[model samples]
Target: MESLSRAGQEMSLAALKQHDPYITSIADLTGQVALYTFCPKANQWEKTDIEGTLFVYRRSASPYHGFTIVNRLNMHNLVEPVNKDLEFQLHEPFLLYRNASCQYTVSGFMTRMTVTG
Candidate 1:
């Protein structure tokens, strides 16, 4: 587990872009957090018309240790089909494996690890 997390960090991967179209509609319930519409004119943070897809990011803890990738469930290598929910959950540190293409590195050593499927 620790090794997987370490590899993720060393790779320096992060949530890059959304798979949805830019013209799509956004809901107010989630607010500006999940998505942000890009404005080339202003170059500022604006509510995006499209929904946000999951991306890859490295999670780490010890400076001396390495990292691994909690990659997307549906998509291998997380190149496409970005989703935030996974089939399982980790109980060690209380983290949810959001589906399909997002890889998240935990921040610390988990006391336990749990998966739904």
Candidate 2:
């Protein structure tokens, strides 16, 4: 848990460096908890109870190669709030931008292995 907190702090610092309007301060990350569960069957992370803006760092190969934000509000203009699980590949990386409230909880699972001899 301590390591995760430190990592969140570092990510917040890096986001600030980007000077992105969507990115918020480190304080926004306070009181936030991250939970992870591994599901070997799917080989993907099932995320739930996510209440915040999610930012994905796009590589140079991507068209919008920068920090792109994804939030429930902007997700296909849904009439109701999201209540379903969002899945992401374990091999891919995901970054949280900011939580809407301090009480919000972010949960997911991921596993990646690198084989280099």
Candidate 3:
């Protein structure tokens, strides 16, 4: 009887842990500039140019899985928001240029495992 009770308690703990939120969220990424790197070929990592600013609007998170949907400034791809997983590593944060349009852009963040070599 005691063993069965312990098993139930463990399962409850596991469930609670699964419901935990990922560390990063949309609010944290909004208004920040980000870069995404993808390897067009094996052993080579390619990074996107700093074309615009990043605006994270919606995000889904859990202890082990999560993704963010973000909008970029000046990058009108017709594909509104981009999806980024939490596992991706966002690099250094810096500032961007503001032309006559009076726009403020951040440096940029990068995706995880963009390069293998």
- The C-alpha TM-scores of every prediction are 0.18, 0.20, 0.28
lDDT of 2 by residue, 76-111 (tens): 311111112332233233222222222222232222
Off by over 4 Å in 3: 1-34, 40-42, 59-86, 90-117
Clashes of each: 24, 0, 3
Candidate 1 lDDT tens digits, 1-117: 222344543332322213222212111111011223234587654532333223222213212111122233333222222233334455544333333444332222233332221
- Best candidate, TM-score-wise? 3
- The superposed Cα distance between candidate 1 and the true structure at residue 59, in angstroms, equals 22
lDDT of 3 by residue, 1-117 (tens): 112255754553343334333322222222233544434465444435444323222224322222232334443321122223112223344323332333222235432112110
RMSD per candidate (Å) reads 17.0, 15.3, 16.2
TM-score of 3: 0.28
TM-score for model 1?
0.18
lDDT of each: 0.28, 0.32, 0.32
- lDDT, candidate 2, residue 33? 25
